[model samples]
Target: MSGATTPGLPRLGDLAWAPALDHPELLAPTVAEALRAWAGRDDRVRDLVAVTEIDPDHADTATLNDMHGLPPEASANCVVVAGRRGDVEQVAACVVTAATFADVNTRVRKLLDARKASFLPMDRATAESGMEYGGITPVGLPAGWRVLVDSRFAAPDVLALMGSGVRRSKLLMPGELLCAMPGVEVVEGLGVAR
Candidate 1:
């Protein structure tokens, strides 16, 4: 029997294959620039590569688990949340493994220092960030949001998934870069148990 592709998942071959097969060297221009700016202070973020992938409408982490063929416990993602403060909209980026949730109502809220932190509207998130819906990455966000990465993703040479600037692509980068981001504070155990 032939292997069939799942609805929200694309085969590895379907990606924009980089012939070099480099793991964390394929970041998008926006992500690359952001990482460079961050590298001035922390060196760990330089090893990351932003990835693009298929539109994953699924909100839960299981979707990523199935798409990447990763165990539910081994996958990690950077979740972006946007809100308003004093008439200015702000964004917050949080990283969590597939097995855990970011706890937007609690952790992300406190991190952003917002009275109320909620997921950004898909349209607004895409339009303001200059990235496609479902493909938002913290690397290219407009200069309004505060970016915070969880230290759990700071492991060297570890693979972390992000948006590809498009619905059909996802970005992958080294986990260490998550710690090296400018203003990136490594909070202890920020991820919520699933």
Candidate 2:
């Protein structure tokens, strides 16, 4: 793919993208499985999703965007949050644009019905999610985990750039696609300007 600048790709940088299913090395084992399953069930997903290699050191949103000279809003970020009420343990994956952060203290806390909420520890997050520490994504989260997506991604034409469940590569798809992924809840106040 010569200078492949697809919708979700950076405008100022050249990234070689290939179908995600064709590059297992770019995904964590669980993420690869989830993608294959999603693609098998929905043909369009198999055709539209793409992945591109990157320096693992640039996996963080700030660094990755800076490396590509991408606008802050060009990508989405995911974080795993956990809180509890009574005997029930609540865990969720919150998604928001890079320009904003998840509203964990107010909006998400209220939604989870917890007195307080905080990001899950890095080690625990990766162990339970079967993904890398810096590359947690909502796409392949556990079935019992709640997935919250910011409502700002309502526009179907907008691209959703996110980790491919690993630090060495990134996933790119239409925002609508990620919002419609299995067990996703699109919330209006999920994101707050940073």
Candidate 3:
């Protein structure tokens, strides 16, 4: 399903983009479910959010960007961080442009109110989030998890090219929509240059 040349779908470079709602197979089950549920109430998600298939080998941000001529800074990366204090565990997904890394040590630690915080292990991240290792998006994260968006991504006309919860496809969405997503907290200074 090459949606290449399809008009109205937000895209960078020559990547094909079809409505994510129309290609559930391209999305991880949880992502598809979340989008469907959100779209049921607000059709904007269906209209503005789209997906494009790519070789799983190109799923990594750098590789995909290089393959499609997408600028590195235009892509958003989802990083999962977790911390514990006594018996309580805090988890958050930080969304930042590829030009920077999430400020996990300071900003995110304060946000989570944890004494220390670090990236979650890949195995647990995939299992707990119900998403693949390289394709975890913030959309379908489990309960009690917060989505922390770097303020840089909270603008109109900005696009967040991110995982579709699967390695073989990517989602293209307005950065505004990502900031407006459920459980999102837009914080300034959340991103640190890589």
Candidate 4:
């Protein structure tokens, strides 16, 4: 808190981070609930997860990384997908490093046990999950929605920069911690090299 750097956190270039609890305005309602639930369940997560504000225009991974001087490798993108099996609808949020792309048609379809899977339309994603487009995150997704995290994220000491459910901010935390979120599943080959 004293210097420009946050002790123990991975370098985030020019972004200033504080406990997520200290910046309620940066979080959507569901995101706040997700953070609270994680904090209650994991001491490590409670101690490490942080949030920082950013310009909405620079919220996308590429722009945010370039404008903030953050490493692209340290960032992750979440994508939503929807598919149906018989009469049931299946939805999931896929998390992968910015350097890779989610294998939605193959792995995701297999995981959801659907004949086909595709990116959910933006309006439907936003309406169903209550998260803004381009800012949808794995955290706080509806209870029945699966959260698929790429296995690479389980690497030790990896810090992932992800959306905060709103365009105005982002969350930073250990990638492994995100893998531990309720209903989160780490799958090998979930993300394919771009």
Candidate 5:
């Protein structure tokens, strides 16, 4: 509403990523509610802003180029992989650029300590994350679950897009800020380019 409109979310070009997460208007309903709940209790986490761009067909490495017009390395995808070890329900929601793919078998497997782990089907991931099927983000996933990020996302210029707890919308914020989100862990030397 303040600047030029993006497809479904705000454009990363429109806002400044500051030390504090200041954009709450960009969130979809569920994420907004969760953020409000979280922010209401603790004042530490910044509310990162996101601009959404939706595609009917889930955009993969090649399709993203034609659909979003954003360079592959410049954009990231949030993939949700869930598993259970003993009584703990392990959920790993990752954000990696189109130029890379999350090492699901290695990075996530050990974290969850599951002999077998698998990516939650798109429908289930979206459903559990409370976001759209194609727009699942690591932001407002179920609490107490570990969220691991690729170390590459810590770069200064990267404007990472994540889910806003809903499919039809997104939260666009600085990659550094995302890495700083509460409970986010940066795996050293992790990530492989696609």
Candidate 6:
């Protein structure tokens, strides 16, 4: 599977991308399932998304982008947040470009209408999401968790490299595809320039 390129692999200059199926070891079960579902439902998504493996140690967006010669803006980071209002608890996944940061404390809090909002503890995040802490993606999060995508991802044909629920590989797909996922809410300024 080393050099084989499938329809799902986009032509990212200098990036050695392969079909997500070729690197199953890098994906959590939920993530792989979601990819398959997307591919089955939409030919465009199947043709636009791809996967590539990397050293697990370099999985963080900044280091991975730098090491892989990918522009920082081409990568998106997924962060899990937890909020509480009275007796209710809410969780959300926020997606933002590497060059920006999520507006968690303010916009997120307002959106959730919670009295308090903060990053979920790593252990709890990994346990509840069934994904590695550093490799969480919005694709397969549990039902009911709102996915907040930055409006910057709405641009046509723009690719965003994101985690595949494991640190050893990354998914590359059009940002528009991400926005189209169920329960995804695209909000302007959700990602503030850093």
Cα shift from native, residue 115, model 1 (Å) = 2.1
Off by over 4 Å in 3: 2-6
lDDT of 3 by residue, 1-194 (tens): 75345567787778878888889999988999999888887768978898998999999999888888998777989999997777888999999999999988898999999888999999999999999988999888897898899998887689999999999999998988888887789989899987
Show where candidate 2 strays beyond 4 Å: 1-13
Question: lDDT of all predictions, in order shown?
Answer: 0.57, 0.82, 0.88, 0.85, 0.62, 0.84
Each model's backbone clash number: 15, 0, 0, 0, 11, 0
Candidate numbers, best lDDT first, in rank order: 3, 4, 6, 2, 5, 1
Per-residue lDDT value at 185 in model 1:
64
Residue by residue across 63-137, what tens digits does model 1's lDDT show? 755755655533556667865556765687666776677788887777666778887777876676767655566
TM-score of 5: 0.73
For residue 52, model 2's alpha carbon misses the true position, in angstroms, by: 0.5
**Candidate 6, residues 1-194: lDDT per residue as tens digits?**
48876754665546688877556777898898877777687776666767887789999877877776888777889999988999999999999999999999999988889999999999998998889978999988988789999999989877888989988888888898889877889989989899
lDDT of 3: 0.88
- lDDT score of residue 42 within candidate 2: 81
lDDT of 5 by residue, 33-108 (tens): 6656655655534434444444436334355446555566656677777776777667788778777888878767
What is the total number of backbone clashes in candidate 2? 0
- Quick one: best lDDT, which candidate? 3
TM-score for all predictions?
A: 0.67, 0.91, 0.96, 0.94, 0.73, 0.94
